[model samples]
Target: MTDGQFAPTVHDDIELARKMLIGGEWVGAISGKTFPVYDPADGRVIVEVPAGDAADVDRAVAAARAAFAPGGPWRSMTPQARGKLIWKLADLVEQNAERLSMLDSIDSGKPINEMRFFDVPFSVDVLRYYAGWPTKITGDTIPISYPAASGGRFHAYTLKEPVGVVGAIVPWNLPLLMAIKKLAPALATGCTVVIKPAKQTPISIALLAWRCEGSFTLNIAVIGSNITGLKRTRIRPPTA
Candidate 1:
């Protein structure tokens, strides 16, 4: 289909949606399994997306772990630097709002006009707002007293650091908006992410993942049946 002929409408066949995005790579399901994606407009099959499983989740988690490790580009960047990148991403999204909204409407079966005028623009603004917070996050200086010292001199302060490796599982209702909302805050604080977009509306999330490549260190994964496994994973490492 030509670019000008492309319209924001869900495909009639659900098998058309059968695909998986794991670690920024789009591929078929682990076992070549597929699930139907319904068109809420008429309760018809729009497409079939890859039926992701345990192994796929593991792979995505590992990718996110690597991205969040010390010395990794995402982990090594300063908070402000990371925040700036997120803001840039937000800008890109804003610039491509029309296309993104179209994708979102097609994938989620939302009204194209509403997605264009409301959902997409609001989501972009949310990302931009969160982007400004990193520059303002600062530690507090604490006053301390050492009574037993000859010449009492004590200084203490707390440093707020980014929690690493966020795994976000967004619902299908507002796939694009929810993904961006989760992504902006997590990345702004210097955390790498593995986003498991809803199986039904996975295309828009996959498109976002594709767009984010080389712009930031992000891992995109699909959650088929094992939602529980992803829920058990923590945003940060457990305290000792």
Candidate 2:
């Protein structure tokens, strides 16, 4: 297929709902506003997605924070189990690669072959690669120069832990890969994620959120919105 051509047959198997994934549940924006997502292939109206505002962003952030809280499902899960779930997500993406490619092609106006051959497969590989990191994330022991109160040198060690909730903002070009790139490592490290996919390319992310809801036992929220919505959020990375 040439750069100017679009795939003649576009699959409609994915449920193109105008909803947001908040706390692993599909729901509409609180304001009940929806925005049109255009098919760049021909500038046609592909579907309508939720126009999430500040309230919705706050809800997604809260869900992520709760998931990352102490003793929460996400925080309580074993590292090995987390890795296995990421691996499973990678497998799911692989199983639906063709459909994802087609959807991305329509959403982003990219060539079908490029999405099929490069973007989709790379996302799978990235997820698989990050899946291995959960088990490998470790800290080190250190020797302290200061003497102990009792007279001997003190023993010091560091432990690796998830920082907190992550706010990932991905661009429209190569949407699938970019989202996975932000999500894979964060999930592997036991951090809950609030994803804000580009307004033009949220359909594939919605499909991914659906698959994750079915497969993952943890919390992950993918909200749809334009730039104005998420910018209002004050996400400060946890400082040591």
Candidate 3:
């Protein structure tokens, strides 16, 4: 081996993508428009990714809503099972730490050392921390003040429940970590998610989203733009 050879700086062997993650599949935007992502270090186009708009966002939201619906695979999973899935995701992050660190470094032009030391580990930590939340999330019983209105002998309690689909819009500066911060808790709490990674740095998020494939009941999609808000539903606390 030559002593003067430098470590590999380009990742030609790694396959990058120009699609978005929608409905558990890698797909292109309906408009077929793609915007180039530049390597911050050299200003050269690293890759082109789908330039998703409202339509793409809607598709992702629909998928998330279906996954979050009653009796759906993601919703029907027991809390303990959900926790295990999240823990598995954490393991996946750890396993791909090096690749992820490289992607972030290339995308954001941050030093590889920073991504390796901070962003990557923190993302894994966030997922692991939230993994324990599923089993621990609990509701409590409360004393009723209007007993007369309740036949003078009624009980009241609250059930902590999922808020359905979550929309996560993360910044480019710390793409991986910020995305995990929004996603880990949502996954732990039994909600599906639609993530819009900032346009400048979508590659790492795309990879992370695809990593969820075959890992669990897929409950996440990576795309662009904003999904329409969920209809407001007032859930009354249970009473007996």
Candidate 4:
């Protein structure tokens, strides 16, 4: 997080990292258990990260639910203010493009150049594109074609609002961009998220989660390795 760059590894961003982001804080699992993340290119173990279970999932879901609660910042902010914050998060993604790409490359064994060129840029674009949506969402008042009872007029309308907390599980392939696809619109529309990363490509998502913790007033939680017992509630918010 120093100098707007995340260098979690000691060897110049070559190693996988060991932390989970939950409730806007970087921490370890409650059970203190971890699993190895290996570099695909060399089949070498890069780092060991938290192996979260149903308990961790519960903790994360609680955080997201609270963040989406009536008085939370994510819920209470005006649409315009929310838009501004989402746009700011996009800017932060662009700002940390290099570090994010590096994390993805080391963890997924993807080429650094492609990650820098495509994944990072697309993530920024997706975020920026969705950032403009908060102020644009509108509801409509529908006119009924039926006669009103007792000759009284009736009004029918549809209100477009964020549904609730989102539980996102992303695959290892294209981790960064995939997470962004799930995250941007949800955040822009005033919904909170609890996301999990695949065991193989957990680095990039963790990195982005860390960046998000610093970038926005978001309650983003990252469950590690597996998604066991995370299906108790809503998996995807309506806004997403």
Candidate 5:
């Protein structure tokens, strides 16, 4: 194929989705059960993804916890370092945009041309935008006075910190872009995530895990549910 030639469209095989990524390792579902993913274009079973249960959720959470701990590299790294890593990921995404866009087109039944021209470029832009925020985050300094008259001067400052352990549950309609929109910012801000991608379109998310492997310490968990249990945890909602 020539450099400008568009690659032929290829759909994910069912067996590929059955493999679950947890704690940087690929493993089978807890119950060894699989769920069918249909091709909306024809309503045909295109693939069989793992039917994840509570055990899978637990494993993913544990892995994220390890990455979020005080001494963990993710937490200890400087914001600039984190930003650099994010930039590297953005570059990688650009490098693989064609393949990723093809996967998105197949899994979500969107037009391959649209995914190539619009969705993939938008995702890369979002990553690049968020990558610049790390260094700009700052703490506030406040003036304070002691109750006692003897006190001369006092100053107080509040530092912004990462809200650890984010559970992002995104819809299937636009799985790949949603994952990039949600996961990129959370990871950039020094938080660990357990993403429960919509069951109908799990392949793009699985592909995301594959691409993000070893770029940083991340624990991606796949669960077959619309609402994730992480909603009960201590995650702060994303600011507008």
Candidate 6:
């Protein structure tokens, strides 16, 4: 809906579900457990999200590996093609600006004007900026020579490539913007990703995954389990 469609307020009127996105599909937690997400401004239960734990992580990671593995769609794609996909995402983000902006504002208890005017716009810019980067990635040869084991000197050069799959674990604070920040760069670099949005605010991210699924394989699977081996920084609410 347009800003005018919402008319007097930006509070969104939409239906949200409690599920996780894995391998391009949405499903309930593997354990079938769920948690309530409340509107921060008031203590009202807005939605229920799958309570993902370690098992979910394993599923997502495996799917990501397959999508980014050699011969996979993302792996076989050219950097330019990857850039084009990212650009497409930028277009989608622009098209859904109002809805996404309103979503994060309500979910995070932030001001609508702030999210609509600043956060959402900045995220689009970041996506656009990174969208231009995929095709421009380059490497240069070094003037310094490298001596071989046999004492022969030769010029050295370096090349860059995508690092395969990526995992984007996002926070509830500014969900859309932060998600775009991580996702845009990863996609630009041709790395497939499995993104886990904060349970408290996952609607926007769920929408993003669904939107992209039409274009990419998105080998997403349900990941309610918390897989280990990654460091996580907790974001605490501001102190008085």
Q: By TM-score, who's the top model here? A: 2
**Candidate 2 to truth, TM:** 0.89
Q: After superposition on all CA atoms, how large is the RMSD of candidate 3?
A: 6.9
lDDT string for model 4 (1-240, tens) is 123233434344333247677776777778888888777887877778788777677777777887788987777789888877778878888988888888788778789999989999999899889889999898999866665566667798988888787877888889889988998898887788887888888877766666666555566767655544455643432222
lDDT, residue 129, model 1 = 92
Off by over 4 Å in 3: 1-15, 147-151, 224-240
lDDT string for model 5 (1-240, tens) is: 123222334433223456777777877777777777777777767667777666667776777777788987788888898887778778877887877777767668898888778877888888888888888888998877767855687678998888887888788777777877987889778888888888787776666676677465444444433333345654333332
The C-alpha local distance difference test score for the whole of candidate 4 amounts to 0.75
Q: Residue-wise lDDT of candidate 3 within 1-240, one digit each (tens)?
A: 122222443243123457777787778888888777777777777766777766676677787877777987887789899999989989988988888888888778899889889999999999999999999999989987794576575678999898988888888899899999999999999888888877777777766776777565467877742222222322121121
Compose the digit string of candidate 6's lDDT tens values, residues 119-176: 8889889988998998888888886744555566667888888886677777888888
Give the clashing residue pairs of candidate 1, or none.
13-46, 14-46, 14-47, 14-48, 17-48, 18-48
Sorted by TM-score (best first), the order is: 2, 4, 3, 5, 6, 1
- Please state the error at residue 186 of candidate 2 in Å: 0.5
The sequence of per-residue lDDT tens digits that candidate 1 reaches over residues 13-90 is: 222235555556656756767666665666766556666655566666676676667876766777688677778788
lDDT of each: 0.66, 0.80, 0.76, 0.75, 0.71, 0.68
| Candidate 2 displacement at residue 44 in angstroms | 1.1
Say which candidate scores most in lDDT: 2
Name the 10 consecutive residues with the lowest summed lDDT in model 3.
231-240
For candidate 1, what is the TM-score?
0.80
Which candidate, 1 or 6, would have the higher TM-score against the true structure? Answer: 6
Instruction: For model 2, state the Cα shift of residue 238 in Å.
Output: 15
Give residue 227's lDDT in candidate 3 (0 to 100): 23
